[model samples]
Target: MTPGLINGHLHVSQHLLRGFVPLAVSDTSAYLFKWVFPYYETLTSREEGVAATLAGCDLLTKGVTMVADGGTVRHPGVVADALATTGIRAHLGGWSWDHASAPPGLSMDTTEALDRLSGAMDEVAGRHPRIAPLATTIGLGMSSDALLEGAKSLADRHGTFLDFHHSFDAGEVESHRSSFGDDVTPVEHLERLGILSDNVRLVHQIVSTAAELDAIQRTGASVVRCTGTRAARDLAELRGRGIPVGVGTDTVNVSNTSDVLRALHVFAAEIREPDSDIPSSGLSADDLFDMCTVGGARTLGVASFAGSLEPGKSADLVMFDALRPEWIPMIDPVNQLVLSADGGSVESVWIEGELVVDRGRVIGVDELALCQEAEEAAAGVLMRMGARARIGRRSLC
Candidate 1:
């Protein structure tokens, strides 16, 4: 038994984008301007609601007790309501960017953007005890200076973390660099804006440099590495610096599944580019397990109350079926969990003493009906999107 997994970063509004990406999608820029933005602009409230419920159901069944959203582009209130029904704890925030690079109908004026996120915070409040609202941004490259500063202030006022995407892929790295003339790194830019404090959960650290990693460690900001679109690179280096780190599934479009255990299995397979400063032998199964549970809770800033199987902490537990092949003999629990077992072995899950998942199926919702609604919702959005998405896609690229 363990504290349920925490997806330290998630894109709640992009759930329905799964399985619909046009074949042969390119890097981040094309992905953002062509597909993700268009889908966000066209998604209806009902579609977002169904997607949120679907995401929550999948997460709970996969032993995810807490999820911190990257940001939502549409009706965040509807998404909140749907997750509330699934009984999963979450950290949510709205998305708005003022950069000219932001697609049409997505960007807002500086003040309007800040106000919109603040309003989203208000809307999420009192919705559920487990659902918290925080400050968020699309990405550093797509956010203006004022927006970053404003988000920091908002997070300070709320005493919460500001979840934002930073260096992930090469395209995003170059784009953020083009806006600055100085030789300073990305983390340095945040330092100049007074944004790289303890109240930040920086997502997608694939492109971070040694200097940037130093800055992150110095500032006490946590890192949430997404294993969906990229391999788990330099995770040991992050831990070597004593930086709090967690793992996430990122977006459904790229990930296709929110199962963190399976995500880690893929992560273990794709591990490469180890730093020389770290151990010659890379991460172990136990280390991966820690990242999914307690380390994730710390990254999401809920460690004081949850994340471990302790007496004073919240009651969140995952019970696996020992009779399953994955748990057979149980010679090494951590090894079996991180390397062999999938989420299917999860027999039940308890979040805050509430039985949300029972006997390998989520409770309080018809599994058949949910899948049917998801299919209908996805179909509805795909029809409106026209050639932007199709059913015969081979790769999201």
Candidate 2:
């Protein structure tokens, strides 16, 4: 059995948007404001719960036993309830913003935003005791300096982890430079705010400067590098700096897959030039595998509870069927696991000593029926948001 994989960054509510939205990698603002934000606004609490359930089921079947959710602002309780039912260990954060204006149709001022976040911290503790509270800064560019500081303060007080989006795309980098100044990058801004800490987990530090990278290393803060966004050189540099780097699939709308093995494969292969010497990358299959497991656990601040198979640790592990075609002639277990094997090789999964997936299927839920519901929910949401007309393709079939 392999140690259960952990997805260090995920958006549980955005699972329904998979394949529904066209990704415009160049125009981050249009993608968020036009498609993503509006679609989120259309979801009812029930729909959100259904989406979260679908996501959890997908991850479980893919041998992911734990996740750190980037919670939606509308109905985080719904997401918590779904995750609880699915039996996946998770740390959840609430929707938070203060500096920038709320997206269209959403009403939020700084006072209301802080108040909502404070209430969410208490709500998650009272309602979902298993789920830890994570200080959230929607994104560095979107969150004000006050909000960032407040989030860190909240995390410190609760002794929990802080999660937030950082420099993932060009638009965000431009925004950060414009908002703060030309000299100070987003990482420097975070350092100046005094929010960078060991408890902080910054997502997608793709465009960070040397000073910012220095700050991250000095503060002992971890980073979740999504395979879909960052290059191999960037990852090698982060690893060389002795930073605890974890792998994440990001959102369904972004990477479009919840498979950890696929992400692991990308992380391993993307770091080096095809013709270049492999030794130059300074990463091995073992290192990437550790990132998926123990490294991810560390980023989520649950290393003691999960990540590895050891005495006193939670009974979370995955059994890959070695007889499968993908596992045939597996001379190196780590290489096979990282470079070739995928969710299809997963025969069983156990989380907290309980079997959640068996025979390559999630046990408790009728996955097909749940996917059917997700489809209906997605269609309804798109229709309500009037985004169906904007869909690039006329027919999905």
Candidate 3:
């Protein structure tokens, strides 16, 4: 058994839109502005609550006891209360953005953005041990330099970490170059703004460079790899350099599942570089396991309690059934876990010594009811969005 896994970065609010992003959203920009942000602009409190609960249920059955929200969740109190019903720990990043890319309804000026973020953080503080507010702007691509600095200041004032998506794809990197500077990479631009620090966290940091790696190393920032194999190679380098690394399955809209085991499958098998003889990550299954557990806890700033089963730590553990066919020769537990297992094998899950999941089902949550509610919620929310009429136009189907 191991400590319950931590999904280092995710958008719980995006769960309603899972499997709905059109096939034509070929890049991060489109994924955000076209699909993601439009949904965010129109999401309702009821939808947010249901989505967070469903997201918590998905993570709990998959052996995740805690998660870090990727921001853009417009309703933290609603989402937090819903997640609390499932006994999951969370750090929420309420949305903050002041950029032209944002829909007018969702946009805010720098001062307005900072005020809203600060209010959200304060609004959730001391309310629950497991639920928290993370100072977050969606990313540099949607936030101006002034908003970035202001968000960092909120994190500092609140004595918590700041997080955002950064350098996710080629288009995003180019946008940074045009907005920040042509000469410096996006990471350098953040460094130039004094935004990189030990307390700062980043997600979707796919673009890598020697200087970027150097900056991340020097600033003591943490990175959570949220998507595909491109970041897999850099993850090995990040870990080798003693930089903390964590794993996430991204949004179901993008990856279709929040299962870390699925993320592991992508990491271990597809981590090797194409058209190259040498393996990109040279990491063993055991290393990968650590990244999922303790390393992830550390990256999310919860290692003091939630990451491991050590003495004085929080009681969070996942037990896999050994009688399954895949475990016939379970000589190596880690290998069995990494290679042959999925959420189906998870027999039970506990958080704070309380039984939360048993027989691969989440207690106190009705899968059928929640799913139906989500279906209704998604339909209602999307139906009101002006972007709804523009949807089927993009899908190849």
Candidate 4:
């Protein structure tokens, strides 16, 4: 038996909120402010719960036993209830975004936002033991660097974890470089702020420099590489440096299935630098498999309980269908899993000795209905904000 897949990063509510906004997938930031953040502002607690319920169901059925869900959860209790109902393990955060420069109608007072986050953490942490509390960062524009540092200290004292996006886009990279100058990158700024430690978990970290990588390694921080959303060379470099690199699908915006195995394959193949006098492949099949399970568990700081299939560990596992006819002889499960199999091959999923999915179907659920709700919710948000026309007008204007 093999251990179930550990998702190093996930955005449960963001799954439904994705295409309704224009962030990186668009050509301009106007759509983001005029449409995206306002749309998020309109998302009620109940809507987040629904999204979490549906997304959690999808993950478990795909053989993912655990996920580190990062976001500004307005109601942590509601999120925990959703996770418990779905029967999945999650590290849920009470998110905070207290930046004055943040888009209007979406910004919260810094102190008030922290108060809400703290209340949510207290309410949810005691009620849901499987759901760990984390301090998460939100907002696209520059906020008080001091707030980020303070949140890290708070999370550490609570014996919880910290998660944030780092250097995800070229524009963000440039913004950091221009603001901070040659003295440091945003990550270096984070390091100075005292958040660079084993408890810190970063999503993306795509455009960071080699020196910054060394700093993260020195501090024992972990990085969750969304291979489905990044260039391959970035993953390879991080892997070579002994950084705890795990695999994630990012969002349905980037990948429809959110399958780590497929993400690994896409990255492994994409990062190839044109074989040069090299006798061995840049990435091995086993390496990719380890990234999905062992690496992911380590990145999330849950290796002791979740990484591998061993006695005394929780019974979390996934069974894939037999090798395809093309792979007539099952040479290596690792190879087949990384290079050949998709979500279709997943036959069953077990989490904490409970069966959540069997025979390639989510137990006691209607996927079509879920899809309809997600689509309708997304369309409603877009329509309310006039996002389609707004995007076009912004381009024309």
User: Mind giving the per-residue lDDT tens digits that candidate 3 earns over 108-130?
Assistant: 77788888888889877777888
lDDT (tens digit, per residue) of candidate 1 on 281-308:
5678877777888898888778887788
Q: Evaluate model 3: give its TM-score.
A: 0.92
For candidate 3, what is the lDDT?
0.81
State the lDDT of candidate 2 residue by residue for 157-248, as single tens digits. Answer: 87888888888776678777897876678888888888888999888877777888899999999999776554343666777888888878
Task: Compute the lDDT for candidate 1.
Answer: 0.81
For model 1 the local lDDT of residue 86 reads 91
Give TM-scores for every candidate, taking all chains together and pairing residue i with residue i: 0.93, 0.92, 0.92, 0.86
Output candidate 1 Cα RMSD. 3.6
TM-score, predicted candidate 4 vs. hidden true structure: 0.86
Where does model 1 exceed 4 Å of error? 22-24, 228-230, 272-282, 388-397
lDDT of 4 at 214: 85
Weakest 10 consecutive residues of candidate 1 by summed lDDT: 388-397
Candidate 2 residue-wise lDDT at 98? 63
Error of 3 at 25 (Å): 1.7
Give the CA lDDT, 0 to 100, for residue 133 in model 2: 71
TM-score of 2: 0.92
Instruction: Go through the candidates in order and give each one's C-alpha lDDT.
Output: 0.81, 0.79, 0.81, 0.71
The collision pairs in model 2 are: 232-271
